[model samples]
Target: MDLAQRIQKMITPTIKDQGYEIVRVQITGAKHPRLQIMAERADGTCIDVEDCATISRSISAVLDVEDPIEGEFTLEVSSPGIDRPLTRLQDYQTWAGFDVKIELKTGIDGRKRYLGRLLGLDEEQRILIECEEDEPHTLAFEDVQRAKLMLTDELIAAAATEQTK
Candidate 1:
């Protein structure tokens, strides 16, 4: 098997047993290895850093013992962060109503990039993002080059700051 596949196979279950989901495995240049593992409730809301760090250290230690690599490699374990990657249909489903950025395979509004709120996702796994400049663009999940949540702490705080605005 390939390196990433091998690592995932070895590490995923151990992580899952500890209440963490191995969202994905990323290996770049065979030297820098990062595992994007997310800890969430069964319903899938995000988890805090304490849990993430605990899981990270434990997973790293398990990997160290497994000796998946023949030589040197780095294991970085952390949350997916605010601009979380959209790697699965459920990921899109869970984050609906939140602002996100989607990169389509081809241009929809004379450009390839779109940033807006995710209205909803359908059974076909198409992403429905309501852009600022146009209607809700439905791009097939398979067609998404990259998708992630948009950073808007100010936006979030504004909503929380003034109950009546």
Candidate 2:
């Protein structure tokens, strides 16, 4: 597995045990490497600064022991913002009815990009999206290259409400 994937696999259990779930793991920069870990409560609650610091310390300890990186690197922990990538399968279900942009690994009907309201996962695990005025689009989960929520006034309002709760 890649570094990010390996780190995710190694530290996910510990993070979950701490009452949080890993949203995404990314390593950026070459000379000054940075490990960006986006995390949130499993219950879909907003994570506060204290929670970020807590997770950072816990993850730092694990990374220190593992020594996954050859050189020094900076670690950052934060909550996934309102416009977050739809990484997990549950994300699609939870954020259904929201506008989203999805890119497929292999083109579907000579197109790889799609923008529409999320329709969530179908019974067969395909991602359903209501695109255009016609029938909703069904895509294989494995075919998704990238997917993220579009920032809109409704999304902003929903995020504010979620943060307050």
Candidate 3:
């Protein structure tokens, strides 16, 4: 497996034990590997720098024991930025009514990109999105490639206040 995949496997349990979700993982950089770990709360409140630092230390402890990588690298545990990726089913439930940009593998409406307010899930396990029209668009769970909760000013303000404490 790749470095990101390796890190995710190694660190997921530790992250979850701390009540955080691993949103995405990326390992980039040639000479020195860089591991970027994104985490968030169920309500979409991002894991902040302080949170990351705590998690980072825990993860670093594991890395030291496992010795996954032969050479030196940088470990960056962080929150999924403003335009954070929506990867899990719980993400849909948490950000209901928030605008999301979804890219489908196959275009259902003759287009791949969809920008709409999430309306939660339906009985059929499809996401109910309130698009431009009054009617809601139900997109299957398998369709979304990458999605992020569109951050409103209120969200930013709340996140800022959260960090202050």
Candidate 4:
């Protein structure tokens, strides 16, 4: 497995035990790698500074023991924020009806990028996206390269209401 995936496997249990979910784990920069761990409450609540600090300490302890990274690396723990990434199958289903930007691994119909309102997953587990000009596009789950919600007034309002609930 890759470095990020290996690290995730090691740290996920600890995060889950703390009532949080790992959204994504990314390693960037070849020379001085930066490990970024995006996380959130299991109930979909936003993470605070205290939450980050807590996760950081927990992950640090695990990393120190595991010795996953070879050299010096910076670990960053943070929330996914309002316009969060759609990294898993459940994320697409959960964020249905929201505007999203998705990049495919390969071009479909001469396009590799698309922006549309998410229609969730179909029976075949394909993601459905309804664009402005045409019929909804169905994408294979494996085809997704990157997907993220688009910031909008509707999204902001939903987040605010979720916070109050």
Better of 2 and 3 by TM-score: 2
* Candidate 4 lDDT, 1-165, residue by residue in tens: 988999999999999999999999999998999999999999878899999999999999999999999899999999999999999899999999999999999999899998999999999989999999999999998998999999999999999999888
Candidate order (TM-score): 4, 2, 3, 1
Where does candidate 4 clash, by residue pair? none
Estimate the TM-score of every prediction. Answer: 0.72, 0.94, 0.77, 0.97
Colliding residue pairs in candidate 2 = none
- The lDDT ranking, best first, is 4, 2, 3, 1
Q: lDDT per prediction?
A: 0.72, 0.92, 0.81, 0.95
98, model 4: CA deviation in Å?
0.6
Candidate 3 weakest ten by summed lDDT:
40-49
- Candidate 3: what lDDT? 0.81
Q: Candidate 3: where are CA atoms >4 Å away?
A: 1-6, 29-32, 41-44, 67-70, 157-165
Cα deviation of 24, candidate 4, in Å: 0.4
Off by over 4 Å in 2: none
Model 1 has an lDDT value of 0.72
Best by TM-score: 4
